[model samples]
Target: MPQTVKLRPYRLADEPAAVGLWQRSWQLAYPQIDFSQRLEWFREHWSGLQLDSRIVVAECETVPDHLAGFVAVSPRTGYLDQIVVAPEMQHRGIGKALIDAAKHLGREGLYLHVNKDNSRAIAFYRKSGFTIAGEDINRRSGAPVYMMTWRPAADLPPEP
Candidate 1:
């Protein structure tokens, strides 16, 4: 049977698992980042921030206890602050599911920044309909990043 994954709103209790997944994903993607600094950054950013930010977790039906991936979005600006999938579970549609869920929330557009050196993410986002809007140097890490956005396609009809 195919694995069933469900995306649900994030809760306070999910922080530990979410942070773990974030750390693991970051390490895998940017091995040069210092572990301590990365953890500290996550603590500050992911802590008791606005709950209105749509943070969703992806959990599998077979391994309900584990989170396969997660996506954090800002409703106001339609910015996808974070999207991470466990390295072992990637390329299996979890990331796409997360993005699809965010799009269904009626966002006018979606935006995110991917490290310029992270070609894997850049390609993935491009495949998912995101286009490079600009580039910037991350203030924290001084890394070059590509800002991407996904707007509603002109060919699609507007919602009633």
Candidate 2:
């Protein structure tokens, strides 16, 4: 059985673990990419991340300080910028908990961009109630992607 997990605000001290998990998770998904360069790129840009971005990290009950997953959201627009779970921690509900935390921030809706080729992530978003709002190229990575949006179930239109 999976252990309980707690969601908490990101702290300065948690940066390394969070970045490490981000690096590893992306590495697994995009093995063809130059991860070392990507890791360094993140390290260089992480400090300049917008001050209004909200981040939540998941802590597992069995392993206290070790982070299992994290989600980042834009405070002003409720744009979900990133969500990554350690490969070993995937399918353990950590991602859902982090997303739930984002929803509790009082946003009526949330949106994000996901790589088009990442079928697992696309399926996960679909299961989480997100609908493909549009399709475009990710400016940063130059990859085709889909813009997905989700709203509270109660806010959705009634079924036909």
- Tens digit per residue, CA lDDT, model 2, 22-63: 888888899998677888778766664537677888888778
- Model 1 scores a C-alpha lDDT of 0.81
Give a tens-digit lDDT track for model 1, residues 67-146: 88888888877888888988988878898888776665535889889999898889989998999999999988798999
Alpha-carbon shift of residue 146 in model 2 (angstroms): 0.3
Tell me the TM-score of model 1.
0.89
Q: Give candidate 1's total backbone clashes.
A: 0
Clashes of each: 0, 0
Where does the lowest 10-residue lDDT sum fall in candidate 1?
151-160
User: Which window of ten consecutive residues has the lowest lDDT sum in model 2?
Assistant: 151-160
Clashing pairs in 2: none
